[model samples]
Target: MLDDITGKVMVLENHNGQQLEQQPQQQQALQTPKSGVRRSTRISRPLERYSPSLYYLLLTDSGEPECYEEAVQVETRKKWEQAMKEEMDSLAHNQTWDLVRFPAGKTTLQNKCVYRLKEEYGGRKRYKARLVVKGFAQKKG
Candidate 1:
């Protein structure tokens, strides 16, 4: 039996001349529409009609990796690795940091890799990677 209000399927069984109602194992509760609330059938303008490029942008997914480990695990591992390499090269060229031995009594700050997918004006996607230090861990000078 189909319930009109809840839209749930109810199973009715007769056992020993007694009728029993049994509900399905998996049941989902649906909200019942209020009275005098009719659904609209109006059609609005399509996104492609207004701007095809915007429609394409909306459909495209920016599959950017979250971390360094995830970046190497995805299908575009080479691209992500290249982006990381480029970022490291740029940092080295600009003398961003110096490699030094850790001090015995001081704690070292950790760093994280951030990835972004930038879309150019012509819809070309650019994979960018940035290495940032955790500044919140730093102490006052």
Candidate 2:
């Protein structure tokens, strides 16, 4: 009954199966061309935009790699420029090095170094670069 479930089974009627052997050349005719397709590969890292200008965050942690491509919006860019200008102007106005040519005054007070930091202005998250003079190097000529 189980054999009859799918189809009728044919019994071997003769032992002539070995007599119907094919020539060795006939096997070669069944070969088909092989495909040249390659397996697909993907990268999981973040994409970077290459531009002439790039910025980075200088972190205090010595061994950390802080490389990233940050995008600044137009409004933020304007604000950053303004802030940078203001900071530079302020530094200039302070005459950080105006009174030079003194006799190399107080070596005791020469340990201080001046550094200008970029502070945000006009409600923008973007920042700009600024220049500062190191107070310790101020010479009294």
Please tell me which predicted candidate would have the highest TM-score against the true structure.
1
* Candidate 1, position 95, lDDT: 100
lDDT of 2 at 78: 52
RMSD (CA, Å), candidate 2 to true, equals 16.4
> Candidate 1: where are CA atoms >4 Å away?
1-62
lDDT (Cα, tens digit) per residue for candidate 1, span 37-91: 6888898777666797875665455577768888999888998899999999999
Tens digits of lDDT, candidate 2, 58-139: 2332222222111123324454456557766877888765656556634534332222233377753434444443566666
RMSD of 1: 19.8
Off by more than 4 A, model 2:
1-75, 99-128, 133-141
Worst 10 residues of 1 by lDDT: 54-63
Score residue 42 of candidate 2 by CA lDDT.
78
